[model samples]
Target: MVYTICYALIFLAEILISLFYFENKFERKASKKFLIISLPTAYTILYFARLFNITVVNMLAFFVCNFFLLRLCYKAKIKSAIFHCSILLVFNVTTEFVVMLFSAAILGTELLACLDNSVNLIFQSTISKLLYFSSMYILSKVSSNERRKESPATSLMLFLLPISSTLIIYAILYSLAEYELGQVFLTLLLIGIVVLLFSNIAVFWVYEFTLKTQSRNMELEYEKQKLKSAAEYYDLLNEQNENSKIVMHDIKRHLNAIKSIAKDKAVTEYIDDFIEDFSINKSVDYCNNPMANSIVNRYKSFCDKFGVKMNIDIRSADFSFMSEPDITALLDNLLENAVEAAQNTENGFIDFSAFVRKNKYLSIQLTNSVKNIVAVKNNRIASSKKSDAIHGTGLKSIKRVVKKYDGEINMKFNEDDMTFTSNIVFEIRR
Candidate 1:
């Protein structure tokens, strides 16, 4: 009865560890009631399975219960669930094996004999659970924000520490499981094992720190590239607008002269038609600011070519406080992202509105259709781009510009309606 009680307590502790590790690391899909009922039920089943003393049955129970909870209760993919469950199982088994060896060596008894007494079993269980809990806690804290996969070689290198430690312990057990080592030797061996366990945890902490530093550096590089592109685009648009104005003035003078001297009625009618078409195709004035209008008109033409319905209601707003590069970066990225997402959807549409609110704040809102549900983390949507280096490039650029002007930006994705909306407000500076 004592052994059974101990097993139940150990299983319960493991359940808590699993819950902690998952709640912060993965997305959950079920309600609180479902989690409450399912966890206790899994705990009860796991407790009974351990009673059989069959390693295979115990392992199977552990894996299946955790796997189903991760796959059904949490939103883990099949492969991901399998991989996580296997890692937890390996950690549990390896920890228990190491603790048993430690307990047997210190107690001057055979490995199996260490479990014959409830006191010894309790001691081993408690030590094993503590080591398991500490390692997992560190791992969860370090890896909670990880979104990218490590290279195969990097993964292997990370796992090498624990794998090497486990192998060393396994060899020790196989060679001397039944032998009686002296107190001094056993004490030194126990210290070595403890250090080895901690070394594994330390590697994760160092790697996580290094990864975050690298990610920040990459984001800075991407921002530099975006600013450079925005400046180049602004210059190109400004020059094109100037050239178009000059060309239009010269062409109108020549055409009017030709119209007055033309002899044939057919030729006069063709000239009139050509002038009307050219005038109709002239650039649109989207707002009072020419820089803003240039970027907006550019995207409007893209929408026309791609058959995307675009609605614009940018009432006369002042942008004199904003730099030309800032205007280009803000509008160019916003429209480019919206167009790219909406173009892939059937009957895609983008509705954009910008106006001065109460004469002190400039309000801009954009809503566009999306083909798939976008993933949101910390109230920001993840990028749909394929490259990790350029992920969130547009949003980040917009955020930098907004911050420069003391503006506020809010983004929302309506999964049910398959639309994404961005709302930004900037206070007008005198």
Candidate 2:
């Protein structure tokens, strides 16, 4: 009965720990189902293996059960599941060893002998729960909010580090269980266990720090590229605005000549064609901001070239709350993506609108027809372009700007209508 109780408690602890690690990745219903099915089965197998004194089989069954449970419940790939399971197993072993050590010290009994008492077993299980929960809480607090997929090499490294450390600690515990140790040796072993525990924490901390640093660097590099693009766009718009002024001045000078030649059908036709050709490339100013207007007009020309109809409504919107670069980057990326998607569809059309809502929020919405099915991964729109890293940067840049303003961005796809919609809302800062 004591052994059964201990096994049940351990099983519950394992389920809780797994849920803590994978709560964000898995659905609650699926997680509950996994716990219900996997826990009892795994505990039964481990219980029989322990009863038969099959130590090696017990350890193998433990890891194998966890790997499969994580893979199926979290819907993770095999390698990712293995890495997660290994980390949990290492923590479990480390906590058990620590509890055993403390219980032995308090009871003045050999480490292995503590397992013979039901009180010690319950004490160990309770301590393990506390340790695991505390450690997970600390990790969750310190970890980055961005969820990046780990590289295979990094995942393998993470999997090995904890397992190796746990094994070393377990070996020390086994040695303590087998024979009495000198004071010097016992002290050294305790120090070694402490170092191993700290080393495990350090490894994970360094890995998370590396990921955060890499993400920040990528953002900086993208910002640099965005700034360069905006600069060139502004220059082109300024030149176009200047050329339009020149063309207007020339037209004024030719008005008298045009009126005199109006009686001649051939001369009038020539003058009208020249005016039309010159004005066709002129930029359309949409909002109070010239930079935004330039970007919209540039994309409008692109849409015209590709036979994608564009409807834009940006009459009295005030976007002065955002910087010039930010405004350009946001509009440029959104329009470019819309135009690209629309160009691929027959009779494609884009609808874009920006306005202030109730004088408290800036709202922007873009809807465009897409020929291919839209794919979203990790809540971000997956780029269909062959060079994903290059083309994917646009959405990332837009997200960065939105995040800076504490705004919300949402994307929805209508399968029936074959339309993709992007909505962004930013709180107006007084």
Report lDDT (CA) for all predictions.
0.76, 0.70
Measured with C-alpha atoms, the lDDT of residue 287 in candidate 1 is 83
Question: Using lDDT as the measure, which candidate wins?
Answer: 1
Error of 2 at 409 (Å): 3.2
Assess the local accuracy of residue 147 in candidate 1 as a C-alpha lDDT between 0 and 100.
Answer: 67
Q: Backbone clashes per model, in order?
A: 0, 0
Which lDDT tens digits does candidate 2 get at residues 261-361?
58887777777777667663477779887778888888898999999999999876778889888887788888888888888889999999999999999
- Cα error, residue 165 of model 1, in Å, equals 3.9
Lowest-scoring 10 consecutive residues by lDDT in candidate 1?
382-391
Q: For candidate 1, lDDT tens digit of each residue in 255-370?
A: 88998999988888998888877753367787888888888888898899899999998965768789887888888888988998888889989998998888899998889988
Q: What TM-score quantifies how close candidate 2 is to the native fold?
A: 0.59
TM-score for candidate 1: 0.64
